[model samples]
Target: MADKIFRNGEIVDGSGKARFKADLAVEGDTIVAIGDLKDMQAPEIIDISGKVICPGFIDMHSHTDMSIAYIPEADSLLHQGITTAVTGHCGESPVPVTNHNRSYFRNPDEIKDIDLPWERLETMGGFLGFLEEIGTSLNITPIVGQGAIRSAVVGFSAERPTEDQMEAMQQLVEQAMDEGAIGISTGLIYPPGSYASTEELIEVTKPVGRRGGIYFSHIRDEGDKLIEATKEEIEIGRKTGAAIHHSHFKAAGRDNWEKAEPALRLIDQAVAEGLQMTSDMYPYTAGATGLVALLPEWAQEGGLGDIVKRLSDKATRLKMVASMKTEGFFSIAEWDKVLIAGSSNPAYSGKYISELAETSGKTPYDWIFDALLETRGQIGMILFMMSEENVKMQFNRPYMMVGTDASGMLFEGPFAQGAHPRAMGTFPRFLGKYVRDEKVLPLEEAIHRISGLPAWKLNFKDRGLIRRGYKADLVVFDPATILDKADFINPFQKPVGIDYVLVNGQTVVKFNVHTHARPGVITTH
Candidate 1:
């Protein structure tokens, strides 16, 4: 006897293969069988005719480390058929916090409104325990953030770590792995991860390789220095012997779009040489991050407080302005592409830099600086920098996966205003627009990107596949009708056609509505 059975569905087993007609039976938190179950005895039998049953989607690169602590229901994630989220991407995790570096780490301004109940956790284990105690609607795994570890020991300094500091950082990585962190992540574009050299990264990730954990990175440069950065990332993986996973991989700005192919070639070359490497990307060309990221790396050193002080100094401000004009992948003329995605100032929340500059009788530079000052370095910006052709090209790669690169946000609340639509629309958009509408990728391949592929990256044998005896984390949806409703202007809306979602054999979403079920646990490698 089974707990429940889903019958009369087309099953896509999440292996990038063909679909088959089958019935799946659930017993407790595992799938008991997958075959013809016409006579299977169970307390409940759900008719899933005209729907496709597949393993629940896994967000390979997520930033819900702190957001999950606030909104544990994970309404947006549940609605998108995401049963598991691989959090702590781009070198932002909530644990291993010291009084010295916790406040300045990650995107604090985005979730400033939510009163996080467990912000004081000091270790990776404590952070995971807090989530379990609060109850989450989906499984969440964390990768120990390299930025947090660096900031805690180095305090936003641009200089190389001392021999003692380097050893301490390695110990932190080993400790985090022991405490259940599945891997290590680095936002190389963000400080102090940016401050770290290749040697430092290789040394610190030694434990990850030893423990068979992955090395996830938001590589040093994604535009002009993309190939150079990719080589460095691969070199680190080679030296450390850790599997490499790139986050939100893209070549930013219009001019650098052509570098996408060469970057892919470099990745392929690494793989051909027996280096294990993969990457995850959202479907859209536009990418979002903190507004302060536009500042030259030197200006951002010494943490937010120091940067704030430097922004107010005329000489320092002039140097920053000069750097902004000639230093980045984007020029001053492209300020319009850098729209304000979120801000503490309600008036400037959704406005672009060009519009805000004209309205405020200031130049784009002045507007950007003033906005950053007003928001206390908390403003978020969306950069429409990548080419659509490049986005589709990445999908053709066998190792490519899908990730929102956005944190979990609520439809209405402290975290809703100006949130990127990717939070709600990423998986559905990949399935609906990319796979079904545009025909860029077949449905089977798309399912594998979000499911089995990511699970394989994390070494989770029991999930990410609709196999007998695997964990019963699954989704059932109407392939013809599924589509993302969230858009750039109004991003708080959820998608349609994701009718049923089960996490750990518990139905958390039915008829596109969350049941407020928190069946998630911290799955560690």
Candidate 2:
């Protein structure tokens, strides 16, 4: 709780207004004052020397759930100047609920290692206890996942929930919110969540909506069915009366190239109609996900073992491939578009399906299946299927904000050095490539997208802005040189020129590197 004075820095308060010079005073975890040469004495004084001091960035659509438990300091992200993250994205988290939903898929480590405690999570506070027992690098606020809720109520089966089942699911959401959850998230393309119809979501979201919690989604499809899916999301929000967020927003496929404008228009219309809506997008042309994302929804019905069984059986593989072909999942000719991002078997990293297939003299499908076998269906793939123009168009939209869609891992960890470049590359890429060179948006405006907008969407009061009384989660950076060096082939490379990051008024990262200080806490509404 000692006092410190930050002297002579340009403060971009993240209000999307104008930047101004100020001398800020930090005492304990909050910014006590901001003025010119305040008549105050502090024990420590740091001269910023005219750098831009902005609020800490928030990742709205992040998936940094388990990684933070291992490397709690989060050197990679904090060095790039992020202080807050929203995990439990795209469904599923170890939230304390109950035995019915808790008996879903196991983590690869837990499945391969111990007979760990498994049951319904009764409270968010209990889950927070688990996190506190471990630790984290940045403030983490979680969204109650619809997939986890569905699993607790109905398992991964695609059948509609009975009345009692639906009621139980609604009660679970109420309990989670009573403890801490800010909102609810759904990954419709993934599992039990993808199988949920509008009616089911409305019933589940009723408790969430009544609690003033937000409802976020990854929607049913990201490629062909996107426009309708977005509209469907809006409809759900309208029905439930919950603020909506579209996770990892993007436009993909040749046919969907023109969908961005209409899609954005639809969002704007929804906003005009008094529905609150916002979205987060990664700054990349490709999208990353589990390799099984290409499988027909029907093929992935029963879960990991089912998918593995289908992959192992030649007849089932043929049936799956035919379904994929009919659905235009990968278009046989474009098989090279998929590259391995990570695998339990590290030998497959960076190799494309086409390259691996050529080596074995088999089709890309066979190569993917073989790799799936080796990794036990835990392989991650980066699909180079999005149009760059479509991507830029979405980024230029004002409502679009920044999200890493990645974890807070080091160059080496359970997450290997080069997995998804977005992990270390997103914020810097926004600053260096787009803001500075491409003239995509004004620098301050871009900063707002990464910093303030996300905080606003999640209703994080008194954070994500440089103002008196707000938490002093701030970053000082050199605008001219900030950039991300990571690429698809080298995903974990550190970004350059982010000088200092303060999380919750703690200098967790200083002089452009991690202090390896675990100062983060589990944040709640």
Candidate 3:
């Protein structure tokens, strides 16, 4: 007898094949049987007639690890039918902690009220062990962040690494790979990681390539230099032999909207040349990041303390503003398009830069500097820079996959600040709007991108499919009613029609409500 059986559902097995009616059985944490399981007896049987049964969605890119310690239940993600997440993305992870880089481990402003044991979770192995000990709501495949690794060895200096330092960095990558990291991720636009030269990136990624791990990167620039950045990423992959993945792939800013297709062609050319290349994007047009990203890279050097000190000086502040204006930073002509996604000050939360500036009788630059100082450089901003047409076009591409690029949050909690709607509604939005309504791609292909495609990319052998003997991570939803309700004004709203979700054969969501189950595990390549 099986532990449970799901009967009468239309199965889309995450293989991009047509759906078919079937009954699936699960015993313990694995799917024991499939096809006609009506003859089998089980302790519990679920009749999911008329519902679509598919493999649980795998978020190709996420930063959930940053807050998973506090919100272990992962309410927002479970509600959207995500059973696994590729975390530690965009060159940010909570590991490789040392005396020289302890302060840079966690963003103090992002996490509050919870006491985390930083010492015990210092290295990649230690962090994975801690997650196993405490349990999580979704399986996490952690990518060792290059930024954290660089900071651990060389602090935040922009100076080139010494030969000894380079060797030490390579050793860290090897250690992380040995400790179950799937790959090394880089936020090339951010500090520390951004400071690295192309040669340094190729050298560091050599170990990951040798170990069959992917090199995921948020490229240096997504605006005027989008094509060049894509080429740079391809060169790193060509030199290191590592599979390359572009994180949150986008051509940002109004002036660069037409660059999307050309940048993607660069990826296709690389793929044709036999280099493994892929990219992921969220459904929304706007992108979110720290407000500090507004400053010139020079001003963003060192730590938060250094940045705050510089912002306090009137002369330096004016110089930074002038540089931003001259460079047309982020290709912005209007400050109204920039909204505060998160802030330590409630007054600034959910408001646009232009609105706040106008109300205070200050210029946008002055208001921005004041806000950063008031919050100690802990503000988050959302820039509406991408074209909607480009977003739809990208999703239609065969190599493009979906990712939230946002952290998990609950409706009512400290974690529920002003967040991008993607955090709570990425998968459903992609399915409901793009696939079901707009007909961007066939339903089967859309499901595959969120499931099998990402799983195959990460080399997950057992999950991301509905085969007998595979791990029984699944989701059952109504195709017609599935839709994402979360928006910029109310990001905490959950999606509808996600009837049931299972993680490792245990029900984590039933009737669209979380069961608070912690059956998730730490997955590795």
lDDT scores of the candidates, listed in order: 0.87, 0.79, 0.89
State in Å the error of residue 15, model 1.
1.4
Superposition TM-score, candidate 3 onto the true structure:
0.98
Give the runs in model 2 whose Cα sits over 4 Å from its true position: 96-103, 107-123, 328-333
Model 2 C-alpha lDDT per residue in residues 359-417, reported as the tens digit of each score:
88988778877778777777788887677776678877778888888877777655454
Clashing pairs in 2: 96-121, 97-120, 97-121, 98-120, 98-121, 99-120, 101-151, 101-152, 188-194
Question: Which candidate comes out best when scored by lDDT?
Answer: 3
Better of 2 and 3 by TM-score: 3
Ranked by lDDT, top first: 3, 1, 2
TM-scores of the candidates are 0.97, 0.95, 0.98
Q: Which stretches of candidate 1 lie over 4 Å from their true place?
A: 103-120, 329-333
Question: How many collisions between residues are there in candidate 3?
Answer: 0
Positional deviation of residue 310's Cα in model 1 after best superposition, in angstroms: 1.5
lDDT of 3: 0.89
Show where candidate 3 strays beyond 4 Å: 106-112
In Å, residue 398's CA in model 2 sits off its true spot by 2.6
